[model samples]
Target: MSIKKLLFMVVAFTLASAAAQAAPLRVGVEGAYPPFSWKEPDGTLKGFDIDVAYEVCKRLQRECVLVEQEWDGMIPALLSRKFDTIIASMSITEERKKKIDFTEKYYDTPPGIVAKKNAGFSQSNMAGKRLGVQRATTHQCTAEKMFPGAELVLYASQEEVFQDLASGRLDAQISDSLQASEGFLKQDMGKGFAFLGDMISDPGCQGVGAGFAVRKKDTLLRDAMSAIIKGMRDDGTYKILNDKYFEIDVYGK
Candidate 1:
């Protein structure tokens, strides 16, 4: 080929690749919950949920972009096409299913309660204590339903709930066990806190673990994401990522 022709072909291929990369699919994340999704000191989002979403995109042969959205508004944003999907450790529940479809669950964790260590309260003593949980989350629903008379204080994010609990504004807090273990119980701020043994058992409150949320009409996107999750499960990549952050195999034996 002539030098001029070869140069032109190279330029054309470069432009095509740039366009493809620019057309990445945007995925929403809360960017405030550690061990699941959180923003680093440098303002970049990083966590298990973010990693899992990237892996799924890799399998689908699509470029992935992370969009930070408030946890409370994630669903509404997705429905409005603010993003193509949500991988913010959102639990797949029937209520959510009514508004949006989900890929197969990618992770599962139980619910647990955190209370002041010397508050003289155990799992059995949670009758009237004020409990804090993130608004619109399964944890909040579980706390309200399972502990009917207990006071429930809803916050906008897990960090806010924990902050209140740490400041003694809340008697206790309920959240995902993995997050409790890794992000709270294992942290410096958790030194004086303890996890009560009681577990919230409502599948609806706990949901069917966590999954990717896509608009109900996006069957192509949903199926493609589901296939990626299933393949990861079969090949052990999913478990590896889970264990890296959770220190436990969340996928079960």
Candidate 2:
């Protein structure tokens, strides 16, 4: 047999072997956040972030497995290898970068406050009114640092923060503006509450925006997802997703 033909066969075999060995990536998402990710009543996970994850895996020629993780536990789970990456709407903050690596901002949105229409809450004169935010989140950190005088309450989930806001246990709730808008203010339970104050931006706390979180050593997967995100944004898939889940560009200007 010719040496050229033998070399061709060897190359094809090696390529096939590598393809066969590549494992599906297990992606973690906080299932409680809507528009980004959530479990359907039927228990299947679906949302903008999930869609993005599946497409990214498709582009990389790998299967994507979705794992539901509590918002606060996502980083720990990733470090423990509970999942390969976190595609939840986790913002890319400086503080988080110390522990895990992140893809470029997949999406960015401002933070805001919510309160009963008649309730008076502001950065100024917030001494007596209480505020609530989801624990272990940028919102919690921002509220703590920004509202030094207000009594800040932290909840395990954004839903709980909204619950307390509705029940009057909290005079106000702080969260991602999009979540406060579409997730609560537009819903039945948000009947009397309205968005308060301007959209908040503090790079120290909020950073640029949300990104796919990966273990620090997993540069290959991180780079692949980042390329896919840039491709989607250039193409129109990202905008299509933004339109589907939200009325505004969550990716920010």
Per-residue C-alpha lDDT of model 1 across residues 1-253, encoded as one tens digit per residue = 9999999999999899756745688899998899888888899888898999889778777889888999889999999999999999899999889999998888777888888777787766677889898998987778777887788888999998888888889998999887887888799888888877766678866778888999998898899888888889889898789778876787542
Return the number of clashes found in candidate 2: 0
lDDT for each residue of candidate 2 in 24-50, tens digit (9 for 90 to 100): 888898878776777899999888888
Count of clashes in candidate 1: 0
Candidate 2 regions with alpha-carbon error over 4 angstroms: 1-21
**Deviation of model 1 at 177, angstroms:** 0.7
Residue 185 Cα positional deviation in candidate 2, in Å, after optimal superposition? 0.6
State the weakest 10-residue window (summed lDDT) of model 2.
120-129
Candidate 1's error at 127, in angstroms?
A: 3.5
Question: What are the clash counts of all predictions, listed in order?
Answer: 0, 0
